[model samples]
Target: MFRFLTAWIRSLSIRRIPMKIIVIGATGRVGSTVVSKLAARPDIEVYAGARHPEKVPAADNVTPFHIDLHDTKDDIKESLPEAGKLIFTAGSGGKDLLQVDLNGAVKIMKAAEEKGILRFVMLSSKGSLTPDLFSGKNPSPLANYLIAKYYADEWLMNNTHLQYTILQPTALVDKPGSGKVSLGNYTTNETSIENVAEVLIGLAEHNSSVGEIIEMSTGNEPIPEAINHLS
Candidate 1:
């Protein structure tokens, strides 16, 4: 009876542990930050999904998993069964923008839906909803980026039942985060990548940030308060 009771207690404790959150594109600037921040939380575990798993940080709560955007959805899903929340921070790296940013993103969303994981957060750019926002020359890099983002953002909203938050920051800067931001209509032209990472993690766990496409930048309001206003 004592051994049986001890086994039952152990099972209960294991069941109480929170699910892991996977950060896709974990080698990137923003994605690495997400892995680090989420790893610091005692309640959360992080899987750093990167094209080269060796490049990911070595943290006890963070596990490196290899995931190429070109890989099949079944392969990606099989590699990340423990992931309950999926955050997409992958960029085209100046090559295969259509495949990586659009098609791959859509495939990931479908995998999430099939797996019954409802939480997803995408790191997107501002002006993704408007082609006219580009003022530069034809065949612009920025224009191409926006076009890919536009389709992915649209697909997530139109198809998936996932609790999704798409953050469209005007421009990303490498400066330290202020932990304050303005959500809905960009009030500032640039935002720190650190702040964007924080907001992504916040959206993964917080109920207030769900179901919103926030145009974010550094601002007066605190991150939590700004996200709350969105819902």
Candidate 2:
């Protein structure tokens, strides 16, 4: 009877363990917001990954993880902590597209796979799905950035076995979030950074939209409702 009781207690203790999630690019505007949101949950341990770990905000349940996307595959794998879910919201801002935007994202994906982190959520840009649209009459300066995102997203889908959700939000504005969003293709090309962060949080916590490429913008539906409505 004592052995049986001990076995039951061990199972209960394992069930009570908090979920660990890592947010890459935790210092960025959207990434920082994600870190703050995730940290508020008592059942989650948030690892805020950044090139400059010092920049990560101080909060309970939040730990600063040092990660340089420019590092080699082995270094990146070594740097990553063991976590169940990972959110990739880092970008190069067109400064070093090849290194930061393109290769950096790919390297992290590979490392995440190697580390056995199964769930991945990528914050991408709108129009990334249609790279050829940027060409012809008027080429946008953001063509390269979109292209990088395209391939990174493709690799996540084709090259790796990680369960991934790629979120493509339109042009981001600095407005506050309404906790509402529109999922799927929309005509408007504007979405608040706050709303994007909220959507990312929903995706991470709910584990919804796996193996899906979601295109989102500011909309009328509540964030939770919109996420739940995903098929």
Candidate 3:
């Protein structure tokens, strides 16, 4: 009877385990929203990664994890929680592109790979897939940023063994989300920050768009329906 009781307790522990998702850049506008959305789901536990984790809002199932993208691979890996999925929403905003955008992102990818994280979701820019579109004599000022995203995205796709989803949204706006989006190659050049966060939550929950780069813009389709259509 003691052995039976032990087995039952172990099974209960297994069944009660929640899915842990680590959101890098949780202090950012998009990342913070993602953290809040994921936290509302009882089955999900969110690890909000930020340099200043204290800024992460207090919430049940939400743990603030300190992560410095500029840190070494070992240090970054040590700081990361043991999570099943990781979302890379961190960016340098062109302040220190080489260090923060390119190298910093690659470091996290390496750490995630080493940690055996199952999935990686990257928040990229819309024109990252095609560099030539923005390059030439009179290139857009965002050329450098797009280039950084391109290489980082390439590394994620080619180098990592983890299942990955790359969301590429055009110029972000602070407007309220309509809970809708258009997925594909779009030239509208405007997407709501809230919509991006909502889509990130959908991707995390459904595990859709793996191995796919989705270009997004503001649209009339519901977020869930758009995500389902992609799947």
For model 1, state the Cα shift of residue 20 in Å: 2.2
lDDT of 2 by residue, 173-201 (tens): 99998877889877467999989998988
The TM-score values for the models, in the order shown, are 0.87, 0.92, 0.91
Cα lDDT of candidate 2 equals: 0.89
Model 2: residues >4 Å from true position, as ranges? 1-15
Cα error of candidate 1 at position 114, Å: 1.2
Higher-scoring candidate on lDDT, 1 or 2: 2
Candidate 2 at 212: error in angstroms? 0.6
Off by over 4 Å in 1: 1-16, 134-141
Ranking by lDDT: 2, 3, 1
Q: Per-model C-alpha lDDT, please?
A: 0.85, 0.89, 0.89
Of the candidates shown, which would achieve the greatest lDDT relative to the real structure?
A: 2
Candidate 3 residue lDDT tens string, 33-69: 8898887888889999999999999999999989999
State each model's C-alpha RMSD to the native. Answer: 3.5, 2.5, 3.1
Total backbone collisions for each predicted model: 0, 0, 0
